[model samples]
Target chain A: MASTTEILEKILTSPPSAPQGIAYNYLVPNIRGLETMVKTLQVKGAQASGYPTPAASPQSEQSPTSTSASNSSEISLFAAATETFSQKNTNCSIAESLERCKPIMELAKQNNIRVRGYVSVALGCPYEGPDVDPHKVAEITATLLEMGCDEVSVADTTGMGTAPRTQKLLQTLKEAGILEEDLALHFHDTYGMALVNTVVGLEHGVRIFDSSVGGLGGCPYSNVATEDLIHLLHSLGCETGVDMVKMAEIGDWITKELNRPDDSRAGKATLARIKG
Target chain B: MASTTEILEKILTSPPSAPQGIAYNYLVPNIRGLETMVKTLQVKGAQASGYPTPAASPQSEQSPTSTSASNSSEISLFAAATETFSQKNTNCSIAESLERCKPIMELAKQNNIRVRGYVSVALGCPYEGPDVDPHKVAEITATLLEMGCDEVSVADTTGMGTAPRTQKLLQTLKEAGILEEDLALHFHDTYGMALVNTVVGLEHGVRIFDSSVGGLGGCPYSNVATEDLIHLLHSLGCETGVDMVKMAEIGDWITKELNRPDDSRAGKATLARIKG
Candidate 1:
C-alpha cells in the first residue's frame, strides 16, 4: 500500500489535466501527516529533472515560470463543543484542545497554509445533554477566529441536531460578530437533520458546508451513522460544482474498495433506478 | 405476537380518556386492520353496558358527549411515487393501488372517518432515478384528492432530497393547484436531508409534516435511515405537541422492544447526557 504522503503526492502530481477541478482532499490527523505531505512535494521536485511535456494540454496555461508558484495550502483543526465530549473525543479538555491547536495553526501560517478550524458537537454533544450552552460554542468560535484561523466549521458530530438548536447556534454566532461568510456547517445525518440544518444555515446566509462523499464517517465514540454531505448540498439550490453522477459512482467505488456497504441513500437509490 | 388490529385497539383503549381538543389518528394498513379496529371499538362499547364513570374524566371531555362524537375516525393509505416502487411495496401498480384505495377512502368517508393519503418515494424513487417527473407526482396527488383524501403527504422515502429538488417539487404542486396547506412533507434522514426538505416545505408554506417518533422505520428496499420526525419538528421552532422527554423514553423503549439498535442520534445523545 502507498504511504499517506505517496498517495497525496500521486494525487497532487498526477497531471492537473482532469476536467474536474480539485478531486481530492487529504486529512492530516496530526503534525506528522502534515510533515509527510510537505516532504513528498519536496521529493517530487527533486526527482523531476525537467518538466515532462505538460502531462496534458493546459487550456488556461500561464507561463511555465508560474509552475513553481506555491500551491495554496489548507489544513483543519477540530475542538469539541462540550468539555466532556472534548475530553472523550480528543483526550483533552476544551481549553486544552484549543491550546494544542495553537502551535498547529501557527505552523500552518508559517508554511503559508490556511487553517480551517472545526468545533464539534456544536448542536448536541454525545456526552452532554442537548442543552449545550450556545455562549460556550460562541466563545470557542471567537477564540479560534482570533487565533488566526481563516474560517470555522461548526459540526454536529452526533447528528443530534434539530432546526431550533441550529437556529440558536447561528444566532449566537451572529451575536458574537462572526459573519456568515466566516463559517461552515458540518452535520451528521445520524438523525436525518443534517440537510434541515443546512437549509437553516443557508437561510442565515451561510454558504460553505463540509460534507463527506456517500455520507461516510461515523461517530467514533457514539457509533451513529450519517448521510453523505454531498447529497445534501445537491438538494440545496447552491452549486457545489460536483457532478452527482460521478459522485455516486465514486461513492460506490470507495465503498467496494473499503469492503463497507455503500452508505449513501441517494447514491444507492440512483444506481438502483438506473440499473432497473 | 398481537395482531396489528389488536395492537391498535390496545393503543386506543390504554390511553383511555382522549386528550381534550386533540385529535387521535390511527393507521390501518389494510381493510382487515380497519375492520378489526371497528370491531374492537364495538365490542368495548357493548361491554361498557353504560357509561360507568368515564376513565379519569376523558382528556377531551368538553369536545363531545360520546366516543363517536369526540373521536375523529381517520386512517392513512400509502402508495409509492414510482410505478416500480408502488408495485413492489404494495403488490400493485400505481393505477391498481389507487383503485384499491378508492374503496378504502369511500368506506372511511361513509363511516364519517377522514382519509389521509401518502405518496412514498416522492423525492427519488428507490427503483427510479432522480428524474421522477413532477407531473406524475401531481397526477397522483390529484387522484388521491379526488378519491376524497382530506390531505396528502409527499414522502421522500429514500431520503434522496435537496433544497432545489424539494423547491421544484413544491412549485409543481402549487402550479397543480395543490395548496401548501393540503400537503404534508415526509422525509427520511437517509442522507440527512429530511430537515432541509422540511425547511424548504416550510418556505413553500407547508404546515403539516409526517415524522416517526425516534425516527423509526427504515426503508425495506433502500435500507436508508430516517430521523425522528418529532425531534426535527422541535428543532425547527414548530410545535409538535409531543413531550420530548416522553418521546425520548418511548424511543428507548421501542428500540429495546424491537431488539434493534437505537437509530435515533438525538435519543441516544440525550440518554447519554441524562445518564451521565
Candidate 2:
C-alpha cells in the first residue's frame, strides 16, 4: 500500500482539471500530514521553476485552467462529538483530537490554506446510538471555529439521524451562534434518511453539503449520493451549478471501477431517462 | 393463476388476524371488482352463520380478539391526472375512467364500504416529464371527493416529485378547498425523494401515507418502504401504533420469499441493530 505521503504525491502530481470556482480538498489527520502536504507543494514549486526537473507541473496560480490538482488550498480535519467515538476512531479523547488539530490549523493559516473541520457522529454515534447531544456538537464546532477552521462540517456518521433530530441539532447550533454559512452537513444513508435530514438542514438555511460520488465509502448501508443531492437541489430551484447528468456519469464510472454496487438511485434513473 | 373473484374468495376466506383499530383495505378496479368483493363477503358471511359447511370464519365484528382476517370495509380505486397515463393504465381517458368508477363508488356506498381514490402521477407523469400541473391534480382530487371517495391519495407514481413541487401541489389542493384530513400521499422511492416529500406533506398537514412492505411493487427504482416511513414517523414523535420491529421482520420474510432484494434500508438497519 502507498504511504500517505506517496498518495498525496500522486494526487498533487496528477489532479484532474476542474472548472473555475471548484475546489479540491484533502483530509489531513495531524501536524505530520500537514507538513508532508507542504513539503510536496514545495518540491512541486521547485520543479515548476526548472531546478533539475523534467517539466513544469501544472500550478493553479500560474493558470486558472491548470490541470494540476488546484494546489489543494483547503484541507480537512476531523473530531468526534462523543468521547467513545473519538477514542475509537482517532485513538484519542475528543480534547486530544482537537489539540492535535491545532498545529495543523495554525500551519494551514500561515501557509494561506483554508481548513475545514469535521465533527463526526454529530447527529448519532455507533457506540452511543441515536441520541447524540446537539449541545456537544455545537460546543465542538465552536471550538473548531475558534481554532481557525473556515467552516465546520457536522456529520451523521452512522446514518442514525432522523428529520426531527436534524432540525433540533441545527436549531441548537443556531442558538449557539453558529452561522449557517460557517457550517456544512455530511450525512450517511444507512437508514435512507440522508435526503430527508438534508431537507431539514436546508430549512435551517444550511447551503453546504458533503456527498460521495456513487455513494462510495458506504459500508453496511451507503453514503449519501452526489448525484441524488444535486438532483434534489436542482429540483428545489436551488441552483448548485453542478451538472447532475455529468455527476451521474462519474458516479457510474467510479462505482464500476471499484466493483461496488451503484447505490445512487438518481444516477441510474438519470442515465435511463436519458437513454430512453 | 386465480381469477380476481377467486383471489377475493381466498382472502376473505382466510385473512390474517389484526389487532383492534387496524383496518384491512383492498383495491377494487371497477363495478365488477366491487360486485365480486361483495359476493365474496356474502359467502363468507353465510358460512359464518354455520348453516352447513365449516366453522365460522373469524369476523372483525364477531370479536375484536378473533384471529381471522378483518373484513375489508374499504377499497381503493386508482386514476391518473394525465390523459396518456390514464389511457395507458386503465384503457380509458381520464373522464371515462372516472365514469367507470362512478358505479363502483355508488355500489361501495350502498354496501357501507369506504372508498379511497388514488390520483396516480399527481406529482409527475412519465410521458409528461417533471412538469405535472398541480391544478390538474387538485381538480382530480376534488372530483374524487365529489364522487364519494372518503379520501384521495395523491401519488408521485414516477417518483418525479421534489420538495418545491410537493409544497406547490399541496398548496394547490389546499386552495381547491380540499381538507388535509381527506387526503393522503403516496410516494415512490425511485429517486430517493419519498421521505423528503413525505416531510413536505406533513408540513402541509397531510397525515395519511401509503407505503409497501420491503418496498414491494418497486420497479426500475423502488417503492417507498413501509419500515422507513414508520421509522421516520416514530422518530418525529408521531405515534403510528405500528411496531417497526415487526414490520422489519415481515419485510425481511416477504422479500426473501419473493427472491428479491430487500429495498428497505430501515428494515435492514433495524434488524441489524437489534441483532447486534
Candidate 3:
C-alpha cells in the first residue's frame, strides 16, 4: 500500500504499450492518492510530450489525434457493502468511505480523468459470512454511480457467491435502476464458484469483469484467473478481443517471475495444446 | 484395467461400511466384468453372511431385514456419443459398445441388480472438437435408457462444455423425452467450467453429479473435486447429505496418500477455516 505512489510513478514514466482504446486503471484510495497520481502524471508529461488532456477527459469529444498512453490512464475508488468490512478495509463506515471518495471524485473530474468505483464484499463479507444483503449492495452501487463513477464493479471478495445469491444481487441492483452496461462483476475463486457466478452475471446481462493474471494478487485459493475467464468467454462465442495464446504466455511468464505456480487452467491447457 | 477384477475382489472381501440407504456402484464394462463381480460376490457371500440375496435384486420388495451392503450394489455400463472416443476408450464403435452393454444389462437384470448407463463425450469430443451434436447425445441417452439402464450419466469427459452447449444438450435430451430424474451429469474440470456446467445441469432439473475425491483419478486439470461440488451445492441451500468437514478431511488424507496436491479450492478453504 505504501509503494502505490512509487508504482504509479514507475508506470507513468514507463507505461506499457497496449493497443488503441485500452485503459490502464489505477486504484486511487483517497484524496492523497489522487494528488499523488496527478503529480506523477504532471512530472511524466513535463518529461515527455505535453500533458495528454482531452483524451483523459470523459466529457471531451472523441479526437482521433489525441491518442497517448497517458490519455488512457484512469483511477478507481473503492467502497465496501458491509459496515464491518468497510471499517476493517478502510477504517471507516460505508457512508464515510463514500463521503471520503467525494473529494477524489471531484478532483478527478476537474482533471478530466475517468473514474471507476469498486464495491468490495458486495456479495458476501468475511466478517458477515454469506448473508450479505443485496439491498445494501444496491445502495452502495447507486451511490458510486451517482458520485460520478464511470463504472462500478461489485466484488465477491470472499468468493462465497452462489448462482442464486448472484442472481438475487443482480436483480436487486436492476430494481435499483442500475443498467448492466454501467456495472462489472469481480469474483475470487476461493470456493470454485467464480465461473458459475460469472455465468449468472452473464445471464443478468453484465458484460465487464475483473480478473487477475495467472490468478495472482490474492490468497492461494482466491482469484478468478484471467486466462480461465477469457477461455470460458471465448468458448461461449463471446468476443473478448484477447488472444488466448498471448494471454497464456503472459500468464506463464508472470507466474514464473513471481515464483508462483500458474493457476490458470486454460493457460496450462493452452500451453499443452501449443506444445503439441 | 487388468487389476479391476482384483480390486472388485478386495472390495467384496472388505467393503467399507456406508449408510444403510447408500448404493455402491461399479463400472462393469462387459459380461466378463459382470461375471467376475458375480463370482466375487458369491465367494464373499459363502465366506460371510450366506449370500445376501434379496437386497441385491432391484425388483425385490423393500423388506426391513434385507439391509446388506451387497444388496445396495449396482453396475454401470458405458457407451459413447462419438465413434472416435468409443474406439479409443473401449476399442469399439458406438454401436458395438451399446451392443456389448446389452448382455451386461440382461445379466444384471437377471441377477436383480440396478444398472446405470454412461454416455461418454456427451457434450464435446476431444477428437471431434466442440461441435458434437446434442441429438447424438440424446440418441445415445435414449438407447441406454431403453436398454434397461435406470439412469444415464452424460459425461463431458474432456471438460469442453460451456453453458450454452450444456443448455443445448439438456434441451435436446429433454426434447428427446428423457426425464431429468433419469439422468446424471459427469464433468471433468480440465477447462475449469465443471461447476458452471453443473449449474446448467441443475437448471435443467438434473440432480445427480459425478465427482472425484480431491479431484483425483484423472489428468492434473480434470475431475471436479467432490468437496468443491458439495460446497457449492450446500451454499446454494441444497441438501447433499454430505458432511463438509469430513469430506475435506478425506480429501486431505487421500491427496497426501497419492502425493498429489489437493485440487479442491473449497477443501483447502474448509481446512483453513477449521484450523483458524
Q: TM-score winner among the candidates?
A: 2
User: Candidate 3, residues B67-181: lDDT per residue as tens digits?
Assistant: 5544357899988899998898899999999889888998888887889998888877877887798999999999999999999999988788888899999999999999999
Model 2 CA deviation exceeding 4 Å by range: A17-22, A49-73, A219-221, B17-23, B50-69, B219-221
Interface RMSD measured for model 1: 3.1
Candidate 3 stretches greater than 4 Å from native: A48-71, A219-221, B19-22, B47-71, B219-221
lDDT string for model 1 (A1-276, tens) is 998666677655654444323434455567777777667656756766642323333564655543443233467888888999877767888899888888777767776667888888888776676788888999999999999989998988877777788899999999999989989888776655666677688889999877665555665432222235555555555577776667778878887888875656667655655675
Instruction: Considering chain A alone, report the TM-score of candidate 2 relative to the true chain A.
Output: 0.89
Specify the CAPRI tier of model 1. acceptable
* Clash pairs (backbone) in predicted model 2: none
User: What's the CA error at residue B250 for candidate 2, in Å?
Assistant: 1.3
- Fnat for candidate 1 (0 to 1): 0.66
Better of 1 and 3 by DockQ: 3
- Scored by DockQ, the top model is 2
Ten-residue stretch with the least lDDT total in model 2 chain B: B49-58
Interface DockQ of candidate 1: 0.39
Ranking 1 against 2 by DockQ, winner? 2
lDDT of 3 at A96: 96
DockQ of 2: 0.72
lDDT of 3 by residue, A1-276 (tens): 549877777556655444354567998877988898888777876776643333334544464444554435798999999999899888999999999999999999988889999998887787888889999999999999999999999999988888889999999999999999999999998888888889889989999999999899873347899999999999888999899999999999999988998878888878876786
